[model samples]
Target: METNLNNQISEEWTVSEDAIGQRIDQYLSHKFPEQSRATIQQWIKQGYVKIDGNDTKSKFLLKGFEKIHVELVLQDRTEHLPQEMPLDICYEDEHLLILNKPVGLVVHPGSGNPDNTLLNGLLAYSSEQKKLVRAGIVHRLDKDTSGLMVVAKDGETQQRLIDLLKEHDIKREYVAIVRGQLSHTGHVDQPIGRHPTQRVRMAVHHKGKPAITHYQPLRVFKHFSLMKLNLETGRTHQIRVHMHHLGHPLVGDPLYGNPNRIAADVVSELKDLVRAFPRQALHARQLEFIHPITQQPISIKIGLPEDMEQLLEDIEYYDDLDTFDDQMDVEYVE
Candidate 1:
């Protein structure tokens, strides 16, 4: 482990993008062509590089045309710390990538899941710079929600994707088995923020930012309903919060829903399928966004998991299926 005092590297560049606003780490990645991500992460951790002298969020918006300054510091070792992990890569190209994130895989490390997160998997997968953490994580899916996600390989493309998400230009939709038989179609518009008494849970609070979830009920069983939900604003726990606020928390949600709420009739019919459906019954079913480099629309669809599929089969077997059609069009509008 050798170290060096080449701890300061300085550069200045002007933002050329109108959409590339606040995500400074990503912006500078494009601006500083020769500098690698390993150097950027080191700079970020050392408080050397900043946007307008203020440290900014990785997901923060970028306002283009700002004259930015950067300072970089080199890590002690530039060698790759490699760990072997398998990934189910869906699509891959020079600028963009897509992966099928499995359930129980934490997207990034936190309190309980400090090691072996999706980020760690990405680190092992990255054949690029050795020390950068923000290699290509453009967005994230909750640990329990299994499905497809897109990642950016470089800084310019990453900023464009982030900007698209912020502007609601991108589209993301989810499917989940939640409690109760909800209306055929409805939208929940509520502001979600951290709970006052319990920090872990989210609630509809006046101080929280605006959150909207449009749901179309697809099927109904004795008690539970399967619905497709579309997000308007990307916020933490937005779908779950909005659903719970509507008195229909997702089935098997340990954190927010009534765990024992599965009605006897529903449970009796789902005896075999119940064990398979363990976690919160949510899956990111579809994703659509513009290709930043190609400027063409890309849409990908993932079918439901075996558990969800089995659960629905049982629902149909138990009674005359009063399920609503799943053939409706969903589009995002302001």
Candidate 2:
């Protein structure tokens, strides 16, 4: 039997005689087959599950005819109202969706942004998503960074995709223009965490989560370099912080970049143009992973956004005026 109370969905079941001596977690797993065993065990640990109205552990042995109860606390979905907005979907199927998120579009609602976010648009696109947590959003890109993102259509697939991300099965690649002349492939293996004093920014700290960013220069300009990057771990602001830590912050990065990094020899107009660029010159260009439900591989790639294309064109035009020299190429050493 099931019932709803306040914001919780309560369910109860009587253990059958055939199930006697089974672990509580095992029994509950049979009852809620859609949920993972870890999730069921977490519920037991959190005191959401009870046996005959008494809190119990997941290891408790279930006796015949014992009443098992589960209370699932629902997330606050009412706070987000659906709003119609255009979505740049790259691929879509019954199980998931891949979309190109534009710059300045907030992924979800937060302190100041309560609506008009991608989550609201997703709900408007498919009312079914309102039932899934965060509208099935498993990953995110910064508001100022444009890129590809995958959104699950169901809870089971959502959990699977999350597990894949944690296991580093998903591959995400990006292209960026950074303020330096990189002549070789390099990588930054660092720890990233919230800044000690700056609450809004992330920093490379010793006590932070492990993060690795591998980068190769696609084109080295006179002062700036266009690079292709891959992330081995996705910590918040991982790429931005790692690049900044390398003294090569992404061009036009508002938070971690220093405008003074521009070389003085650069022409005045080009310097102003680089400084006036609005957002970070980073774009997620490729995404590859195995479909969680279909067991097939999926790969999607997108061209550079218009702004980035134009920025690269401008840099090329200015760079042609300077004498060309072959930069020595070096490999990144751990």
Candidate 3:
């Protein structure tokens, strides 16, 4: 057996004949004394552990001579610092707090992003929030996506909410501006997993986890559409990937959108708005779920953000011009 400790954090190890057949997480627990089995399992689940250059589950049985690589960010859990940041509180109670998370605020601390996250903000928002792991974050939105999220104030409520999410009882709805017009409702029932080549991105793969996204056209423009979407199965970047699969990527999505492919003949005003747009044109518009502790139904709705609202106006203006052109063409033919 060969053991290589890269630094105080991260390491590589070759599975030994004696350690063969043991669960990967269990093996790591005995190898790394500083971390617990649960922490090791979490690292595996989060794709921090790789066996023979591939991500595997915690229960994977090690084969002798297999190479294992692990990123050791779990050692830095204490580095998260509480900071006083503005939190848009939509609803709050002793059991939970529903917040409208602003764009650009990371939900939790991780490698390269060590401080000033929403988790830190929640820690400072209330002392009781500190008691819950990850500030009771039951779900997450991308750092650039602005919208609603619920934070549990206690352990019991946190677990309850987590279970509710697993059961798919929590309803989450989003609004987005896509690059092309969509005439009717559509659903993308595809699977999503890590991109095989681009490690940082996600892609649709047959072997990946199931992801279902249902979208309807709320308003259509000549070159853009306002859409409302609901998720039946949550996967990372599910909406963005599904929309891209449908060939109507979100207007401002830097990852999945092809900005260069935007129609060349678009009105200058609408084009300018698209160029000025900085982030993805996606927002969590509504959320409905049962209160974990109170055992009552709850719902919340919010309108588009300032940037999205402005972009919608530009789309409408361009659409009006197209309508006028169509009418003129019809009259000229007569």
Candidate 1: residue pairs that collide: 21-62, 21-63, 22-61, 22-62, 22-63
Where does model 2 exceed 4 Å of error?
1-22, 25-59, 63-78, 320-334
Give the range of the ten consecutive residues with the poorest summed lDDT in model 3.
325-334
Q: Give the residue spans of candidate 3 off by over 4 A.
A: 1-79, 321-334
Task: Report model 1's TM-score to 2 decimal places.
Answer: 0.74
On the 0 to 100 scale, the lDDT of residue 97 in model 1 is 83
Per candidate, the number of residue pairs that clash is 5, 0, 0
Total residue pair clashes for candidate 3? 0
Tell me, by lDDT, which candidate is best: 2
CA RMSD per model (angstroms)? 7.7, 4.7, 12.3
Model 1, global lDDT: 0.72
Quote each prediction's TM-score: 0.74, 0.83, 0.73
Residue-level lDDT of model 1, residues 1-334, one tens digit each, is 1224564556666667865654666665655543555555556666766667676554557777666566655442323234567888888888778888888898766798767777667767875423333556767888888888887766567667877888887788898878777746889889999999999888899999999889987666556678888988988888888888888998778777866665666545464455346788888888898898898788888888776676666665763346544454422111
Ranking by lDDT: 2, 3, 1
Predicted candidate 3 versus true structure: per-residue lDDT over 1-334, tens digit per residue: 2333433356787888998789988888777643446767888888988899999998898778999987743333334578999999999988888999988989998887888999999888876565456877889999889999988886667777888888999999998889886757779999999999888878999989999999887776778878889998889999999999999999888889866568888877778779779888899988999898788899999888888888888777665434433322122100
Model 2 / residue 75 / CA error / Å: 7.8
Q: Compared to the true structure, candidate 3 yields what TM-score?
A: 0.73
